[model samples]
Target: MRVAVTGSTGRLGSALVAALADAPFTGPRGPVAWTRADLDLDAPAGVVQALDRDRPEVVVHAAAWTDVDGCAREPELALRRNGEATGTLAAACAERGIDLLVVSTNEVFGGDREDHTGYAPSDPTAPPNAYGRSKLAGEQAATDAFERAGAMGSASLGIARTAWLFGPPGRDFPHKILDAAARALAEGQPLRAVDDEWGTPTYAADVADAIVELLAEDALAGVHHLVNGGIATRATWAEDVLGRLSIDAPVEPVPGTTWARASVPPRWGVLAATPLPSGEPMRSWQAAMADYA
Candidate 1:
């Protein structure tokens, strides 16, 4: 199948490209087109036009305005990328009878929820911050497009929500933490991290693999949570990452309130997938972190 992956330049998108490079459906004879350009989220109309011209069998929508704090500061840009862009892609896919897979976020759930363990697919969505709100809007827009295009066929939309993604060649939490640790060690400064915030850390490679599996499975439609199996606070995660990297930086535990951020981060928004026919759950965050380190 000819697949078009948006945001092919991002960490997760790049990983997906690597995974698909050797995929059975994308070998020397198989069909695959990996693009990091032309489908820019900033130009939704241009993206739709490109998709219409390419007429790919599947469209993986991965581009988005992911800066959480930046989203809070600039909601208009967030809505444009996360919300309007989704609708445009979904509509384009619906018109061509192509499968549209939208990569979403765990932040859609209000972080204020008391249950920090994790969120389920059925859980209610109440975004606590602007980022979450924008993502939720994107989800709704995709769903609405699917509903309006019911005449096309059965469920052409797939929402794969993940969290705390980290890997090589991308600006992610693990890289940032390790960079900070190295700087602190070099400057003889102490590294401080928030112990209050909690969530699952997903590896970009694992997530890319899961997306391929989901696309191949016929029964894997609708909303699904895709993340690493385990959960941990930022402090614990930082310490584990440092330990794995053989770094001896002392990470000080600090509360979320102590950070004094402008927006209230979700105390907990970890997620668990609702079981797939492949019977494979996401790898544990610890295991993923080890590989990432």
Candidate 2:
């Protein structure tokens, strides 16, 4: 299978590149890779042209404007990068008979968090922030394009949504918390983190592994949450990282509202795999973070 991957140097994208290297896949010229400089998704016409040049059998559309607060400040940039960029890629993939696997987010749902019931893939989506709304728009655009292509002939599309991802090669929540702990340890202060924000932290490597599996399995399509098995609060995750670091520092738990400078996430964003995959559940965030440093 020939595969082209966008965001090829991102935390998740780099992980995908590593995972695909071991698999029985190759690109037209070789391992197809596109960093931001290689494919500026904000100007989406370049993406279509690049894909047309690569002419791969499959494309993993992982690039997007993911800064939440940044999105709120510049909603147009968010929509153009996350929404228009995705539409261009989807439409091009459909026209060229290329399979597309778009990476989405858990923020796409803003339902009652008190329900505690993890979100199913079939649930209706209503994002609470510009970032989430733009991502949802991208998902809808990709789905519509794939459906239209299917109506015309054969085309595969999968939207793999994840949340609170952490690992090497990028700055994630766990890394932030780790940095906080180091500073606190040095200053002899307690770490302050929000206990109200609940979400399942995921390992980028694990999520990337699932994406490769999904792309290989043409039978599986549509939205799927490829997160760790369970959920935990931000404070809990921070405390766990501290514990893993063997740092006996005190932690001050606060509500997410106190930490919300621009946008506040729902109380719960835990995602469940609607239909179980062939492999075991992804390793817990803590387990993955133990090797993060």
Prediction RMSDs, each to the true structure: 1.9, 2.0
- lDDT per residue for candidate 1 within 1-293, as digits (tens), equals 66777888787888887777667775464334445366666777776667667767887788888888889888888888899888887877776688888899988988777745578888888988888888889988888887788823644788999988888676678778989998898999889999988888888899888888876775446888888888888999999988887889999998988866656667887886667658978778888776766
Query: Against the correct fold, how does model 2 do in TM-score?
Result: 0.93
lDDT of 2 by residue, 23-42 (tens): 77553344577887656876
- Tell me the deviation in Å of residue 149 in model 1: 1.9
- lDDT per model vs. reference: 0.80, 0.80
Per-model TM against the reference = 0.93, 0.93
Scored by Cα lDDT, where does model 2 land? 0.80
- Count clashes in each candidate, considering only residues at least 3 apart in sequence or on different chains: 0, 0
